[model samples]
Target: MKRTLSLILLTIALGACSTQKPANDPALVGTWKGLRTQTDKCQFLSWTTHLKPDGRFTITFFRDVQQTQAIQTEQGTWSAVNGKNELRTDGVRMPDVYTYQLVDADTVRYVSVAAGPSGDCQEDYAFTERRLR
Candidate 1:
């Protein structure tokens, strides 16, 4: 009887544990665009993040406002943290951590942390519109 009771308790605990959903997959697997806004400055930038199934990612940033002008572009490795909700970019010269929240399948919000000449600067409360390929 004691063994059966223990088994039942263990089963209950396992069931409860299994009920906890895994963190949402990092959804930055496609092109994203947003109006890059800073203190009194705003421009349009396009971003592309590719997430491989093998836990690797690549990110690209491009300036899109200038159709005739040469686009400023950069690319680097990326990783998802905090259950694929937060993204960290590697090999960038500025602030590298981005907190990404998916508003929908076609939209995501991100906060970029950057360094300024005076001190550390943070760009928060920003939104990105997903670009359909």
Candidate 2:
């Protein structure tokens, strides 16, 4: 019986080690505004991206630093990848994969990796963002 109990405890310990840390469910169903560091020409873009719970997203770019003048807009969908550590976006001009981490309750840092068709062009962008609402 003692041997059986030890085996059971060992199994339980191994199972515990395989579990992941639980986190509060973060909802991206709102607008997020931030500075996106671009690498194509090395510039910062003022952006407001909208997200929905249904995985739909819209990105708006601003020409002014104050984020008042709208320059362009694009729509896409976002999905979680690599066990939620990364985000994959589709239906956009840049179709990118972004790896991100939460810095705090209201902030997150994201790194997006992009590649061109010829396979010779690749770029990465780092974005510092805050939840707006």
Candidate 3:
């Protein structure tokens, strides 16, 4: 009886360890905005990203640092993969991967992995996003 119980417990533990969490992170389901300072050519820019629980994401870009002028908006799907955030835009050929860390319950900082510009800019950027809702 003791051996049987130990074997069953081991199997259960192994099964638990094998299960993985869902790809989408619930904490990211909200509106977030950030600003970036660029070169003279690009100037100040702002990005507003809205992530939904259903894996849908929308990003709006502004030409100014204060997010006053809307420039473009892109729709995409987002997921958490291998401890990183992956965003697949609708019309883009490649997905954008970002390494992120939650600063607090209402803030997250992300750094784009050499995947090129995440917006209309010419290079990758690291920025912080604050939850709007």
Question: In TM-score terms, which candidate is top?
Answer: 3
RMSD, candidate 2, Å: 7.8
Worst 10-residue stretch by lDDT in candidate 3? Answer: 114-123
Q: Per-residue lDDT tens digits of candidate 3, residues 29-128?
A: 8999888877765678788999988899999989887778899998988987554998889977688888898889899988887462454453566789
lDDT of 1 by residue, 33-115 (tens): 55454444445544555555444555555655432343444444455555234333445444355566777788777665543
Error of 1 at 102 (Å): 0.6
Cα RMSD of all models vs. native, in order, equals: 7.2, 7.8, 5.8
Better of 1 and 2 by TM-score: 2
Off by over 4 Å in 2: 1-25, 37-40, 81-94, 115-122
| 10 residues in a row with least lDDT, candidate 2 | 115-124
* Candidate 2 lDDT tens digits, 6-96: 9999999999988854542344457889865545655556888876666677878886679888877867666654424323344424456
Q: How do these models rank on TM-score, best leading?
A: 3, 2, 1
Clash pairs, model 3 backbone: none
Q: Model 1, which residues run further than 4 Å from truth?
A: 1-26, 37-68, 83-95, 113-122
As for lDDT, the candidate ahead, 1 or 2, is: 2
What ordering of candidates by lDDT runs from best to worst?
Answer: 3, 2, 1
